[model samples]
Target chain A: MNTYTNRQWIYSKRPENVVDERHYSLQTTSLSTTELKENQVVLKSKYFSLDPYMRIQQSALETWERPHPLDTVQGGAVVGQIQDIHPSCREFEVGDWVLSYTGWQEYAIADVSGLRKLNRDEVPLTTALGILGMPARVAYFGLQDVGQPKPGETVVVSGASGAVGQIVTQIAKIKGCHVIGIAGSDEKTKYLKETLQLDGVINYKKFTTQKEIHLELKRLAPQGVDIYYDNVGGYITDAVIDSINTYARIIICGQISQYSDGLDTPNLGPRFLHKMLYKRAKIQGVLARDYNNRMPELLEEMTPWVQQGLLHYKETIVNGFENLPKALNMLFYGKNTGKLIVEV
Target chain B: MNTYTNRQWIYSKRPENVVDERHYSLQTTSLSTTELKENQVVLKSKYFSLDPYMRIQQSALETWERPHPLDTVQGGAVVGQIQDIHPSCREFEVGDWVLSYTGWQEYAIADVSGLRKLNRDEVPLTTALGILGMPARVAYFGLQDVGQPKPGETVVVSGASGAVGQIVTQIAKIKGCHVIGIAGSDEKTKYLKETLQLDGVINYKKFTTQKEIHLELKRLAPQGVDIYYDNVGGYITDAVIDSINTYARIIICGQISQYSDGLDTPNLGPRFLHKMLYKRAKIQGVLARDYNNRMPELLEEMTPWVQQGLLHYKETIVNGFENLPKALNMLFYGKNTGKLIVEV
Candidate 1:
């Protein structure tokens, strides 16, 4: 029997504010190929996807699903290679690349049904964590289905340099929309403007108040925002809402700004829902999991865009499994430009 | 030439807080019917519709339209009788009851195209201002079209005794939804529970904090709020949002609580949009004007309901045209139930 050592990060504490290393405990275990059941395979996790939702799941209240079960593996998506497969598993072969929700671990035993084979030569393995994966699914559907972008309409996207927002910004441009990208750093704004070629970009850190941000957005989006793809909800959302045109569509993809302490005890902000009434606008919240069944449709369109270099993406890859919890914390600090991934 | 004395409440000033007599100047003018043009008719305003939207229009910022122009007659809907008609007008004769956007004036000359003939014998003429008018229009579409309520779904309506709320509550019940009403007073709660037969009622005044309201709502709606008809936006809305079930639809028809000062300078409230993300919910704003063309559809269904006594409504009619400004103020104070109308 062949044996392997698996290092796993166990979620040990619920966060009241920011999630950090203190919330997780690293544990080591041994896995043997002899224990593999029929139709099961052993996976060596190559990459782990770290997302803002990880923090949201750490929240005490129920979100999309029950708060990540305490004292278990920190559940997340992983891009891995099949290390061993049981004789009953005919679909997958050893050494084949695949995607699985094997979480923050060096090795995991997954049921073959739960794994999706990845074409190693089609795209980079890391893209499964971002551009060709969950983020792209939400961006395609959230903007196209809920936002219903039209030619010449203005679209403002917060967290523009992040995974979903970056895709949303590019897609809006592809749909003939005048896109304005909002990010936290000058570097991210530069990428949005020079590389993505967005119509406008705003670095929210330059503005201290929502009123200031509103004024800047007014100057940039003189035609008024027709669709706002919000990923960071806070003063930035308030300002964008203030700048929306009549019949605007606001797609709530993520509220990373509020996932910290605010999710447990909400942060107070100006009441602006009255603006919805005045503008006859609509705000819809979207989750990538809601569109999981439509992945084939998303990949069919996105795979070509990505291969053709029409869809641009950046990945801030952090090395080492021990750095997983620390890398997740980088998202809240706006330290990463795009998808934040950790390689084991 | 027939002469008449017109008492007009001219909107001379914009209010910073509650709109009252200080914002208007009462003027009396003599008008001759000889000046009436082709396709024009003279109307004697009888019942002035005092709605919460009036305060929204009075805001310093633009709402559905530009701020109500200063130094002009206060714009509003009125149920009136045609006193005279030009030879070119064949649609109606003198003494025919009609609904017109004639403002807060006792007499006015209107183009025939802007008037809809109302049947006095079919229902009380006042019904044209409340149950069968703008309030009912928004209530019908805002609840049925935007809300898309399903049977057995739980609906929570804020401002349950107000113009739009009363109609929304009854329609939600008619649609087989379990309705919970949040109102300002025991009288309104009693009306919602006893008269309207709502499943639950919450006197928001009884609870000082949003958490308390959320707890009470949880106790009342153990199944969770599937639809929230928001006529009042503030802590009440914050609480309802907190207790929403997945895929809940929130309809924003009116924000009476925020109209006074919040419209100009938005009031501070807890930012609960993250809940929207967790629940995958949606919030949509509906304006009566957007569904003006569908009035016939609304009247076709609601007229019989009002006449057959299946759909119940109330009107706090303040006598005399001189009280128009005061009646508009009553809405902000929550002093009137259902529709507040000035009966001249």
Candidate 2:
């Protein structure tokens, strides 16, 4: 009987503000690979996906799912290679790269049915955790389906340097839209303007108030914002909403700005629903999970674009199993320019 | 030359709070009927529509249109009789009842193309101002088109006793929805529950806080709210939003609560866009003017429902043109049961 040592990051405490080491505890367990059940495979996690939604799940209130049950393996997606497999698992071979929702663990036992075989020859294995993963799914559908961007239309993306926003900005550009990206730092804004070739960029950190941000948006988008893709939803959302043109579409993909301490006890902002009435606009919330069944549809188009170098992406990798919790905490501080991932 | 003494309520000053006589100046002018232009008819205003949107336009900020220009007769809908007609005006005849956008004046010249002929015998003449008029246009489309209420689904309406809201609640009931209404006073709640036969009614004034109101909604709607028709935007909206179910549709028809003083400087409310992402909900704004071209389609269905008494309505008529501004102001106080009209 062969055995492997598995290290797991257990979510111990619920977070009221930012998630840190105090919220998670590392645990070591021994797993016997010889006793694998039918259709099960032992996975050695290579990369862990860190998302803002993890903080939202740690909230005391009920969100998309019931507060990702406490004292469990910190639930998340992982990109890994199959170390061992049950004899009944004929679909996959040993040493095959795959994507699985096995969370932050050095080794995880997963069902063969739950694993997506990753072809490293096609794209980098890390791309499975980002450009072709959940972030890309939301950015593709949220912007294309919900936003329905038209050529010559103005699209404003908040958190424009983040995982989802970067893809959203690129897709908007591909759609021939006059795209504007709003980020927290000058480096992010610079990348969005120079690399992403965005029509406009606003470093929201420079603005003291929502009014100042709104003034900057007004100066950049003189014709008015046609579609607002909001990820950071605090004062930045308030400012972008004020600049929406008549019949505008607002896609609420994420509220990273409010997820920290505001999910349970929401922060107060000025009511701007009157603007929706005046503009005859529509605001729709989009989640990547909602399009989980449509991943093939997404890959059919996105896969080709990614291969052709038309779809640009960046991953800020934090190496080491111990830094899993720390990497998630860094997301809230706007330290990562793109997707934040922990590599084991 | 035949002349009529036209008393016009010129919007003299913009109100920071409630609109009143102080904001308007009543001027007497002699309009000559002999000077009617081609395709123009002389209209003697009988019923002046006092709506919440008037207050929105009075705001210093630009709404759907520019702020209602100062020192001009306040723009509004009027149900009146054609006293005289130009020789080339073939559509309208003298003494015919019609609806026109004639503002606050007791008499005005209207182009034949701008008037919608109202048959007083088919329904009450004032029905042109309430059930079968602009209010009904928004109510029908806002509820049916935007809300898309399904059978057995829970529908909650804020400002449930107002002109548009009354129609919305009834239409929801007709669509086989379990309708709940939220209103200011017990009298209004009684009307909603007993008169309209809603599945539930919440007297929002009884609850001092949003949490209390949210708890009341939870008690009333155990399955959760699927559709929310919001005519009032404030704490009532915040509470109802908290009680929404997955895939809920929120119709922002009017924000009467914010129009008085909150329009220019919006009041603060807890951010709830995070809930939208969790529930995959939609919030859309609908205006009657946007459906103006589709009035015939609305009338085809609504006109009969109203005539057959299947669709019920009420009107709080305030007599005399002298009370025009006061009647408009009374809406903010929740004094009117249904459509508020100033009879000249």
Candidate 1 lDDT by residue in tens digits, B289-330: 999999999999999999899998888889988888888889
User: Residue B220, candidate 2: how far off, in angstroms?
Assistant: 0.4
Model 2, A200-285: lDDT tens per residue? 99998898999999999999999999999999899999999988899999999999999888898999999999989989999999
Chain A TM-score relative to the true structure, per candidate = 0.99, 0.99
Interface RMSD of each: 0.6, 0.6
Of all native A–B interface contacts, model 1 reproduces a fraction of 0.88
- lDDT, model 2, position B155: 96
Tell me the RMSD of model 1 versus the true structure. Answer: 0.9
For model 2 the TM-score comes to 0.99
Candidate 2 CA-lDDT value: 0.92
Off by over 4 Å in 1: none
